[model samples]
Target: MTIFAPTTDSHEQQAPPAARRRRRRVGVMSIVMLAFVALCGYLVGGFLRFTEEVNLLAKPAAFAAADGIVVLTGGAWRIDHAIDLLKEGRGRRLLISGVNPDTSVDALARLTDTDRKWFDCCVDIDYAAQNTVGNAEIAGRWAREQGFRDLILVTSDYHMPRSLIEFDRVGNIRSVTPYAVRRDDLWRGDEMPSAPGLRVLASEYVKLVAARFLSTVGIVAKQSVSTRVADLAE
Candidate 1:
């Protein structure tokens, strides 16, 4: 008559901690996967937006003269374009920023196929700048030294945005007019991104994002080494 009552709680009570651990691990993995997917989506969206901005950049129909011109060194024909702008009286002076220390004015003249006379008269070399931030600093200092209030900024098509950001932060130069050098064959009206074009744009976008973040954090090159912090006497 001592029959044991069958208990429904036996299996529940015997469930090991291992089962609970498995559930916890699955939850963590799910969260991680979700976060990863979200990050990918964000990056992809940013890339698309970057490309669209580059494509939509308006080419300057005509460039008006400014106080000076700063040409950032990189890309094919950038310096040549700057030289042409200088000859056209777009600016009174030209600072070829981020130039190699070993590069001579004669070499640059030959490279751009411009007369050495122009380099000797109007061109100033900035061998200190090694990056875009440095470019802004060096150019700003030159502008200040020359008592320039407005400057025409010359760079490749994809680089204008970032360069302007740095220039704006410099707080020395009053105005910066962008004169972007765009190759007709590089990109066209809403055309599909080619391999080379996409690669270049993607690289620039990443750099732009990085520069923006650094600026947000108040991280920038030291003024002492690059630019003078003193207010330019108007």
Candidate 2:
């Protein structure tokens, strides 16, 4: 009987490719897990910071006058508060940005139970904006054209930070006084938050982080609002 000697090379060749593949997969999975953990940490940190910032609106001081008032339409209270400010002589012009295209001035007047004269005289509605980003761009352009140096920016408390950042990106308006619309029990520590409220807060936090990233990357700075809208249309 002829016995073949086992060589080192043969033993090495006998190692299963499947084992190597398994090792490689484990390495990739470990890297992915680490990345996921990092992202979660960042999001949690951002959410905490966002909550702190929004809470500051609980005790707002009296805001001085500005050249114009820009109310981003989302909640009914935001519109009402902005209108109250306008009637109080907070600003010379009131720009109701992000109005629904189908919504007429009369409809808004009816919703707020205001006189038609308010819309006819001081209020200007922009149907161009579809979101907060659009609101900033269209409103910024209007403010620039009208030579408004100062503007009061109104939105929900959670939304104010991101909106201010977007508006500031335009660099046209000299000053923006933020007026947050209070939502009753929005952040009451005494009670557990509703699912819907938590979801909204989480979403806004993500948006705030994204806006900051885009602002830092110079992407937001380079593109004009009209250009973005035209691109979206195409």
Candidate 3:
């Protein structure tokens, strides 16, 4: 009787070729998919950065006259612009939300070129909000308390879209006018050039995408307030 014994060595050697082929295919597909995604991201980012709606917020006429001005903190220009509007009589009350607790009102007044009395009476520094969502929450509460029906919302041009979504959640507000700061060009002599570091543009694009997704799921619903006081406090 003749019996043949199976060898493990040949099988082990052959197995590597199959595994290597599968790995190579997967690597190529991953590279292709990554390249496609990167191209799409760049296109979307550029479009959002240059859109008319995004650029309109910086116009002074956008918030010419409103019941109140709500300045979302983060950008240095936002506070300065809000103070200018206050000085120009844009509104009776100004809410500077997302203030640092460590900083005193007097310090803020100096930074904003307004007096402490003005901050004490007309301005309310909100220390609670730490993000855009928090800015809406805190500002909504204060606006309701002050009985402001119409509001002028101030932020960077790129940030206006997401800010609008957050502010819209507060009901009974007649109009949330967006006042965006121009960031694309900082003039140095006669030429206008792209500002170094497009951080705001990039960040706002991400937030805009997230807001769109959230809106689609109905998270950005307009809430109803029986009385302005009731909704603002809640």
Candidate 4:
């Protein structure tokens, strides 16, 4: 009877080849799936980000006429809309969070076409916040201190969803009214969207995704250095 025994060398050589082939296939498949998922995410997010709704108005009429207005800064339209509403008597008090410290309050008033007195008395320039999470925390504190139960939250339409998350994360507020600014047609001549405009939208979408991830992991609650200092001073 002839019996065949498998040698160690044969097993080792065959195993390595099969294992390498499997690894290559897995790596290729993983890359393809990851690309597909990323594409899908971007497409869906872009669609939602660009699609403006009739209800883009952040604040309801009743809320707009509330005790105070909280405008989270990012886009130019956000500040413009807030200033317009304030001029129109949307709210008695306005808190413009995420203001640049280098820019004087007087300069901001001039930019918004509001009086210096408004900035001194009614409006607060929050210089601490560097991002949306900071905006929410700082604004939330201001709202609580002012005893404002109802507030008009002003931000861009694309940002409202994420802004709401940050704003609401800090408790002790009655109502948050969203006032989304209407974006102009991003498309240029011939109705073709401008590359710069699309780039801006894409950048914002990326930020939103990052924000969502940070929020999920509770990173949003991590106080910044400025926030800690401010708290300690208080």
Candidate 5:
């Protein structure tokens, strides 16, 4: 008789706090998964666009004269091509932005099959730059020293976009004409890109995106670059 009142149905019972927490956690996880998927789609789209743009640079541009030429050291072909541009009078001076610290001007000229007179008269080398940012900063400084407002930027095709970003951020050279070098390792024989080519593109794409983002966000601080202008006399 004391417990005469009917008990509430189990359906009427409120969920426990722990159950609510689990439900909330599941909802959050679902949202995170959706965001992750969306991000992946976006990145894949960007990668495709990057590849297309890089491929299009294969169409050669008309050579326009600039105050100076700057080549980012990668392969012998790149250096040789830049030197050829110099010979064509496309630029008054050629600044090789990244050179081996141990490699003297004599060695570089000899190795590139360049005439020693070219190095002595019109070519300058920078031994300080270790990466793209360094290359931009070093090249900017060299351009300023040479009173050059326009520059011809030489680098591999895939590297052109990123190089442009850095050069733009550096902001001293008023004009830049890109000379994209064709790489034998990429786009083999009108076929689909090889695994290694894809890998290289992916790496470069990520870096390019990062550079664009950082530069946009105003988070790109001037890097402390120790510049070593190679003595052409050496």
Candidate 6:
């Protein structure tokens, strides 16, 4: 009679601790994988949008004169173009930002073949800017000090969007017109400026994203050594 009776228990068997831990690890790994995939997709989409936006800004248009002009270093033709704009009376003052620490204004003047009077009177060499963020910060200070509300920003074509972003974050200048220096302008002789590969564009796009995120997080980029031009003489 006792053997005939069968009862069902309410509690189910629990998994072993090792098995539970394994399951948790697997879950965590899956979540991490999903997050990584999402991040990659986000970057890819953002890069495509960045490329499209950059294309629109590839060509420089005829712009009205501003209070000042700021040309970021690290490339050719940028200084030349900014100097030409200065000669054209596009801006009252030209600030050459991000000069090398070893460089002197006299050297820059000679390299650009600019008039000494222009360098002395209208052009200011900013050796303090170490990067693009530094460029914006230094340029903003210069603009504020000079009572300049409008400015012409000169940089590479692919770099224009990020440059504008940094300038806007400064929140000082009333107006900023970008003068994008395309790669085509880099060439001097019959040799042409080859189009940058995808890798280069992707690198720039990532930098643009990083710059935006860093600013949003209220993290100002660091600068240790900055160029100071004490000697105005060649």
The numbered model that scores best in lDDT is 5
Model 3 ranges off by over 4 Å: 1-52, 62-64, 184-199, 219-234
Query: Clashes in each model (backbone N, CA, C under 3 Å)?
Result: 0, 0, 2, 4, 0, 0
Candidate 6 weakest lDDT stretch, 10 residues = 4-13
lDDT measured at residue 182 in model 4 versus the true structure, 0 to 100: 45
Quantify all predictions' global Cα lDDT against the true fold.
0.79, 0.79, 0.71, 0.71, 0.83, 0.79
Model 2 lDDT at residue 87 = 99
- Superposition TM-score, candidate 3 onto the true structure: 0.69
Compute the lDDT for candidate 4: 0.71
TM-score of each: 0.80, 0.78, 0.69, 0.71, 0.86, 0.80
Decoy 6 TM-score against native: 0.80
Residue 10, candidate 5: C-alpha displacement in angstroms:
16
Q: What is candidate 1's CA lDDT for residue 87?
A: 96
TM-score of model number 2: 0.78
Ranked by lDDT, the better of candidates 1 and 4 is: 1
RMSD of each candidate relative to the true structure: 6.1, 6.6, 8.7, 5.6, 5.1, 5.4
Ten-residue stretch with the least lDDT total in model 3 = 225-234
lDDT value for candidate 1?
A: 0.79
Error of 5 at 138 (Å): 1.3
Instruction: Write candidate 2's Cα lDDT for 57-111 as tens digits.
Output: 6447987999999999887588988899999999998998877667888888999
Worst 10 residues of 2 by lDDT: 225-234
TM-score of 1: 0.80
lDDT of 4 by residue, 70-117 (tens): 888777678878877787898888888877667777788788777777
Answer with 3 or 6, whichever has the higher TM-score. 6
RMSD of candidate 2 to the truth, in angstroms, is 6.6
Clashing pairs in 4: 58-178, 58-179, 58-180, 59-178
